[model samples]
Target: MTIKNSGKFIIQKEKLIIYLFVLSVVFADILGNGNLNLLYFFGLFLIFKNLKIQVSFLKDMVIFFVPFCLMILGEIFLSGNTFSPVKVLVYSLKILVCISLLSYTKKRFWVVDHLTIIKNICGLFEIMLVISLLTINKPIFWRLNDVINRFSKTRLKFLYSEPSVLGILCGLLVIILLYYIFDNKKNYMLLKEIVLLAVIILLTFSMSGIVYTAIGIIVLFLFQVFKNKEVIPRRMLTYFLLGICLLIIILSTNNPISNRFFSMFLGTDGSYNFRWSAAVNVFRKTMEITRYWGMGLGNMNTPSGLSFLLNIGIDYKFANSFLYFFTENGILGIIYTIYLFLICTYNCIKSSKNIRPLKVGVLAFAFVSQIAGGYYTDPILWIMYGIVCSNEKTVIN
Candidate 1:
């Protein structure tokens, strides 16, 4: 085909890709159902199609791929699954794919483009949160309960069987709500909307959600201080206020630092504690057994298989996600896992510089939430990183 024909075809294809993304976002965000989760295809297409195949993005990608590589090695060295390397590599690749799509889409669109669609859906959720807060049980209403109930009759389910998954989704929602409050500065009318988002976040009873939000808030304060070094007084004043608040929480906890802070609200079942303790136990076992590092890759799979072990870890039946994945996966596991996180973090920072500092700051804060052991399964977490990293350096005149 001629260049003109190819160009026209590409333009049409791009439009379709963007439209698909909007559809997927609505399905996931507003509808609150995972039926559209399959629409990840559209997301993949948008990224791969527009991917900057040049080496310009090589440095950014290297930062991303490093952790992924290390995480795979750790998994292999510890678990030793038949598909250790492949499994680890594929998982890591998925993350990079999302990052690519996110950056590519942002470069091709306006700042507020996707923001508007997402905010609209969030607006609905926010309203539900407000209504629930004012009218229902402890302001904890699952707005999509009816939809979820109906959808559950078949295979479609909004709330997954996985607690961590729920936690991850809740984390994303909290970030979006904050994005409105901090970055967009929604008005008094919208303030209620954002407040509702906060309420919904709390209702999820998700440790990941709560922790990430808290961390994001802390980062936002720092972002302000660093970005506006010239106007340090105001930023520093806010920072000081936050510091005092955080100090109170830290000093008052009863359990171990991580447990007291993270699992208190996960309820008194001791489930959270049990899982975390198991992680420590695994590490302890490794310490006793392995004179050098720990278990090798693919060890966790065992006769039980990798999935079962993960489920066990999730319910706190055996271990927590961090300890189980790292310990059984071993020393390499921890390093690689952290590496993927760092790469994602680096990309977010790079993107922030190219756009409005505030947006970058908001995204950077979101990333910090993840690095601090916020759950990896959260779609919002990935979305936030993808959007921020992809456009880390867009030039808008």
Candidate 2:
């Protein structure tokens, strides 16, 4: 009995650790948001200890590694010092730790229950996040860090490392909100909650978020129209009003919406533009050096500073998260990633069919997240993957 009880305690601790870590990452980008929780350290320690080369997991990770492999090989053969592959491989190892924990704690965290906790956590951050936005104005690029450098010192986003960083966060929040919007029942609170969520997203001034939110809302509105038979409900009208209020609160700043959108495409002028251009040049050079395998892992960051000198380029940053994967990993890696996405999405859609309303709602939420931002970051990726994987587990269990 003692042994059994101990097992349950450990499982609970593990799950709680995961929830804490995810919340940390989500809030990490917020102003003055940096500090390592005990949960992060302990959970990471446990995951690495249990690491094994599982066949299926290895196969999935390896498929993506092929492009990385080429880069690693080039770095090894030519430079000999190999500053390239090693750095990427080392960086990638962090994600492996996250993936392992997600897989390890798969059975521990109760899906719907944990999701409720997540919703609550978001509610908590919403307070701090909105407050942070209220204090800042203009597109200064490093608001979070400025909030930090002047006020506090933390690693996260203090002094926004990049505008895409904000864009990325906004994209993520929008996706999360869309999930709730789809799953929640047709009620005034639900409408208000969604608009409130969108308000939170707009505060970030992330072009990615703004563009993604628009697309996501369109899809969601269609789902509502189709799912409920061609009727325009009064609740939706009210929802729009709430959205307008939220918009005024979040977007009625000095920052022009068009300029913000322009920055996303043009690459935040000056520093961001120059840096991204350099990163893309690295991709171009990699293609020239090893079109077959490319520069691989360590070469993920750039070696070149000029796209004009080595114009294997496009208009935007070469290292945009999705673009980086395709450039570094190549067509094969991109294909496998796409495949995993399709499988999960298909399952979510399939699971929605025979489940209860809430479960169906959760599934819809996952779909919109993928559509708006095909991200592969930790916490966001692993935690979401865990929830998606848990869709198959029984609710009662």
Candidate 3:
């Protein structure tokens, strides 16, 4: 083959690796034991293939890994628990592989060109949603609900183990769809995408998903009105209003989804109260035990700590990511996370002129997920961070 053809082949191979990485992320929980680790191994191999050792990149990796190392040390010295070096090593390796893959992808694919990739990922998620809806009653897929009681009313978990996972995945798509809708006013197809994602999100009965979807739509609308000085076209406005009306009607009715969304705020939801109390107790206990340093990476849900919380009537694991980090990595973890957040925000602001709205929307979704929990270590979050912080020049094709 000619050199040009060889180059094309190499690009195609890299893109295939990226696609596999995305699939691994989406199905990480569903694939069962050791599957995610295998995917990470492949990802690391691909990243190593193109990896150029840079002092700056190595420094960033070291800085990011410090908290994990400190957590391991804390667990050994502070917590009178078994020092599981294997756990620490595995967790650190997974993180390193994720970051390396992200860095490689950012350097290979420009951020402006990422719309196509995002759309493809959304397409895969939509396919998964459809399959989930269809197989909700099938015995083969019932094992996916093992995390939750099978006797209870089922939620649309799809290929995921929990409804909230599906909800968050759908929520990410919703943000992307809204990004396209606002970023390109003439793209009429985005309306249908938005409607479909909204339907999927509602099916999951996740309050966080519902809230973030609304936030994305509102942020996009306001940005268009205020920043771009664009008037809402009458027909488009009519459709938007009608959609909102439908959502309101849905929420007002006495259905599982509506109850799940509203009962949390009304203080009638036992699960919500349990999660809130658990989060509070965990935070309090962690603060008392490890005021500056954390209890340890693996100590967040320690059986003894959990037993203590349960003895006091708080029966649940930590559901809030902020609290989880604070308890696991202590004050230093919070500081590091905040620093990364600020860097991502600053980079998004600096690159606003080139696909600014999309970055802002992505960042908003990630921030909301972090606050609401269940997405602290999501690959999508890191992918967005890599894209936002990447220094690659935008190609305006």
Candidate 4:
């Protein structure tokens, strides 16, 4: 084959790897639930086959893993709480592999025009969501009271574990699409994708998705408004009217989405309240037991103590990522995370101005990860970080 053909083949291969890798993670619930995600493993395997390990990346790993290992060992040896050695091992491996894969993908794909690949993936999910909506009320498509229901009606999860999970995923995609739309001078299709993703998020009735979407919008709007003074007062007025319209909808509509948000503020929403309170309770209990050090890695199980806490009679991790980090790794972990975050933020500030949307998107997702999502091994979080930390001189388009 000619050199041009070889180049085309390589690009196609990269696109394929990215598509499969992202799809596996997105459908991890269906393919592999719990600690053992089949698709996640498969994705990592693909990454390893293609990934070029760098000395700098290895050094960064040491920075992350040393503290992680210390936390795990501390939990096993010092903390008198019930812990699982298998979980510790599995979680550690997953985090290492996930970060490695993300770093590789960022260098190979995100810094290039292969970003069209992500947009294509977003289109694929958008199609699935549209189909699910079209088939609403059908046998399997509309199962009522199955995990996440809104007023006895099935919320659109689209084959993911639950609506919240699906919503979070959609929210991330929406942010990416928004970035694409903002960066590109001519992006009519990107705009449509963001709109569809937003609709899907709303249909899921996930407060997390709604919040993430709002944050993304605000971040992008502010960045654009400051970058270009032309949109100042008109855009501000449009946003004000938009917010008012949203408020009116929430107040007037008696649907599950509206009710859920209302209950959330009133502290009556079970999911919202439990997610927040449980993480806090776990952190508090862990601190009390370990004297604020931590309960160690993969050791989020609440010990038998106060009966008032929202301890569901099962071994579970905290839904909040930051609290989870503190509960597991303590002060050192918090310091490390904060330091990493600052570095990432600084890098983003120094990067190209066109990629500001992605910087904001990553930051928004990071906030949502702490509140509505957790687990150190979450690939999406690492993936966003990788993309944002790509070559500073590279153009995202």
All candidates: CA RMSD (Å): 7.7, 7.1, 3.9, 3.8
RMSD of 3: 3.9
- Estimate, for each residue in 180-212, the C-alpha lDDT of model 4 and write its tens digit: 555554665676767777787877777877777
Candidate that beats the other on lDDT, 1 or 4, i.e. the better one: 4
- Per-model C-alpha lDDT, please? 0.49, 0.48, 0.63, 0.66
lDDT of 1: 0.49
Candidate 3 has its poorest 10 consecutive residues by lDDT at: 143-152
Q: For candidate 1, lDDT tens digit of each residue in 12-93?
A: 8765665566555434433344323433555566446545564533554565555566566554545444455554454555
Clashing residue pairs in candidate 4 (N, C-alpha, C atoms within 3 angstroms): none
Better of 1 and 3 by TM-score: 3
Q: Which stretches of candidate 3 lie over 4 Å from their true place?
A: 33-43, 54-63, 66-83, 104-113, 122-133, 139-152, 229-243, 303-315
How does model 3 fare in lDDT? Answer: 0.63
- Stretches of candidate 1 off by over 4 Å are 1-19, 22-43, 47-63, 66-112, 123-192, 230-269, 287-321, 341-379, 387-392, 395-397
C-alpha lDDT of residue 136 in model 2: 54
**lDDT of candidate 4 at residue 162, scale 0 to 100:** 66
State, as a TM-score between 0 and 1, how close model 2 is to the true structure. 0.62
Q: Which candidate leads the pack in lDDT? A: 4
Query: Where does candidate 4 stray beyond 4 Å?
Result: 1-8, 50-52, 55-63, 70-83, 112-115, 134-143, 146-153, 183-185, 228-240, 301-318
